[model samples]
Target chain A: MFFRLTFSSIRHYAFRFSLAVLGLAISVASLVYFLSFGEGARRLIRRSVEDFNLQLLVLPPAQSLTVQPLLPRSLADSIRSLGVGKVYSILRLPYTAGFPPRAMGVVFGRDFSSSLRFISRYEVVRGRDLRDSTVREAVVGEALAKALGWDVGDTLTVGTGRYIVVGVVKAGSPMVDNAVIVPLNLLMEDMGTDRLLAVAVAPPPGKTEEVLSLLKREFPGYTIQTSEELVKLAKSFVALGDAIRFGLSSIALFVTAVLLFAIMAITVQERRWEFAVLRALGATRWFIFRLILAQALTVSFVGWLFGASLGWGLAEVTSRVMVEKFGLDLVEVSPSILILALLVSLGVGLVGSLFPALSAVRMDVREGLGR
Target chain B: MSRLVAESLRKTYGRKAKTVAVDGFSYTFEPGRSYAIVGPSGSGKTTLLYLLSGIEVPDSGKVLYGDTDLTAMGEDARSRFRARYFSFVFQQFHLIPYLNAYENVSVGLYLKTGKTDHGRAVSLLRSLGIEDPNRKPYEYSGGEQQRIAIARALITEPRVIFADEPTGNLDSKNSEMIFRILTGLASEGRTVIIATHDLALAEMCDVVLRLRDGKLVGS
Candidate 1:
């Protein structure tokens, strides 16, 4: 009887209840859509850090956080003389300063004389690897090639210099698969800069800590970071990004809760006589309270169903747009996101219906029946 | 069947204006009998019914049902007591609008037992001359709606039945039929207390009490 009464009341106000559901659905959709991007970016950064395969990175103290031309090219040789590990200099210049860094493709220049661990990991899917480091030749990642329609013989322009594409590479990881690579010395001369982004050091066998201690002592002014430190930094960045996105989505959730609350409050007012009748018929105050709560939860549960689908659909569209317009795929709708959306929507339902349920419980039965 | 006894019952309505709805009313209602409380407007017929049924707390009173004092119990306790032993029919019929005639009757059974007896509800509705028990309250006429309300009260098989103007909205024909049905329940060993304006229907009960100015005037 309790279940029948609750559902019957909801059906009685079907149109009003549907409006509340739609409002809640939109808020939950925004929440799911926003969090997807943060999750995607976090996953990408973690993969890139893991695949780098080097023991340490030597960066200029102030510019250690970003991958850009801030360290002198001589730092690679200075690190190499120690013989603790092989060294390589990498130069990365942004094509254009833009809102999203990935949209502005990087002019990635690295030493071809020694096999760069980062570049060696991916397979050369077409043409050949960068041969003759002095020649004006370049290699492009699979994503960058596909985005710009670059082929093996295509000529590409990067920072006032032109180079023929010698190879197309595939790295599965988005970070490496979205850059245009060239020889470090030629790129430096073409861009008219004697600086490099950073020097990567591969420690011999089990001498990682020994090499790190030696480098940190030798160049106290620089930042020597291990892969573990880089991963920790990435995790912190992901956490901050998640916090900001969730904060922005909270506004929509608040509005949704208020909308539901208003609708439920009005419904309670209209149904006062019915509640009084039920009480007179021997229903306890707790039963009346639970009936209102059940109605609210039903609305939210339906809203969550529609909202999760809409949010995931929106996330997919955003991912496609980022890939086509910005050359970055950074939106992931995971199972955890759906679960979180459900919990959040249910929370809204509970908050929205609390006052109305209390009012129903505290109603004066005699007055409500108009006796 | 349990005997109902009221001692010096008094109830007030407002704080400033202070309308005394029921005042100094005392009576002993025997079991297995029908009693009618007939009064004009604002004469406390409804308030006295409410006080006796534990729906309202009197300013000063002792209403005992078989040695259990209804006035001494808490609100929830009174509600439980009512659910376990009493049933009510109102002036407006008060059938749950969303429920069908059969569901309305079954709701009473559910309230009493925590589960419904569908067969008993259908039987009661049929006995009360509700031809289409599947119809909602709006589909029924005034008399049919009242019949559905009575069926709801009967489904619980309550020991005491309270009817406050049960046929107020019905025609003369339906009013007599309702009065006969209520009187028949008294013969079957259930206490029936009715508050009504129609003296003709009031005289049909075993005892008729008249009231004026919130106090009993004649019997």
Candidate 2:
């Protein structure tokens, strides 16, 4: 009976409630769309970090993660002499904007003989794995291969050098999925430089910090960090981005709440006499109050339903577009984000309806009857 | 079966430039009888009905329904009492516009018992000449809408029914029909109090009390 009364009231005032629902839905959709990007970036960073499995990266001074091929090739042997862990030279060159082959592609030159973890992370889904670091052969990531329409035995051009596509690799991280892996020596030879961008080091168990301290002291002109430190840095950057996006979404949510509140207040005022009739017919103040609240909740819940679906659809479509156009997975619609949106929308309903329900509860039967 | 007593009831409206709506009015309404309070506009007939039903508290005086002192109880307790024992009909029919005939009548049962008796509601609407209980109030004529209101009143099976100008908005034919329904409730051994401007309709009840300037003049 309570549900009948509440829902019937909403149905009768469909247009008015629809305005509220639309307002709320737009707010929730914006929230989901914005937050999904943050969630996607965070996951990408975590997965990329986890996939590398390297304890330390040695980059040139003042360089963060960007590839700057200034470190000498002999730095690998110098780091290997420290007895902290095995070291291998790695080189990476990022494509500039408007590169026909791919704009966001990275040419990764890895020491295939020693970087076994890196090789294993990018599983060989087709063709074969890279062997013999001196061979002029390349393994393309699955997404890059799909983007470029490359298969095994295909020739690929990168930075004025051509190599055979020996294998296609797949990984959970987009970083690996959009990469072109070639032998370190061949890439160095192609670039006409004996310099290296970075060195990958595998430390002994429980000796990460000791190895890091030694490398920082020995290679003062380079930026050396463990994989965990890099992951933390990436997470902090993502967290800051998420906070700003959430803040932007909150403004929309506030507008939705205010719109709902105004509508409810006006609705309660117009139906004051009807509420009086209910009271005279034996409805308690609490009953009237709950009826109003239930009506608001119904509106908000319906809005949430539509908004969540629209937002998820938008995220999926945008993700597809991002991957197709830029080779980036830029949106993620996780279950946690859906749950959070639901909880926040319900809270908006409760807050928006509180005053209207109170006013209904406070209405006098005689005055409401207009007697 | 209980008697309703209103002792020296006085009700004043407005904070400033006050007008006494009901002044020292006293009456004993007996069960199994229909009583009509007949007066011109502003003579306090509706105020007296409100005071009697505990819909409005009297400025001074005690309204007792048998052993229960309605004037002494708090607002919520009085509301519960009204739910359990009293039902009302209004001048405008006051049927919820959104609800169909059956839902309107069933709501009374819902309010009283937190449950609905669909069978009882259908039967009551049928008996009241609302053959199609699925129609909204706007679809019904003024007379049929009043019948729906009366059905809502009867669904709770209250001991007392208060009708304030119950036939004010109806034609002679509808007014006559509404009076018949109220009188029938009296015959069923329930107290029925009505406030109206029609003396002809008032005469149909067992007792007609005249009010002038918020005071009872004659019966």
lDDT (10s digit) by residue, model 1, range A80-195: 88886778787777664345543556677868755556555778999998777789998888887887677999998766789999999877777677878888888988898998
Interface RMSD in angstroms for candidate 1: 0.9
Residues B57-148, candidate 1: write the lDDT tens digits: 89997999998999999887888888888899999988888889999898888887899887888888888888788988999999889889
lDDT of each residue in A2-26, candidate 2, tens digit only: 8988999999989999999998898
lDDT of 1 at A112: 73
Per-model TM-score, in order, reads 0.91, 0.91
Cα displacement (angstroms), candidate 2, residue A32, comes to: 1.8
Q: Output candidate 2 Cα RMSD.
A: 2.9
Give the 10-residue window scoring lowest on summed lDDT in candidate 1 chain A. A95-104
DockQ values, each candidate: 0.69, 0.76
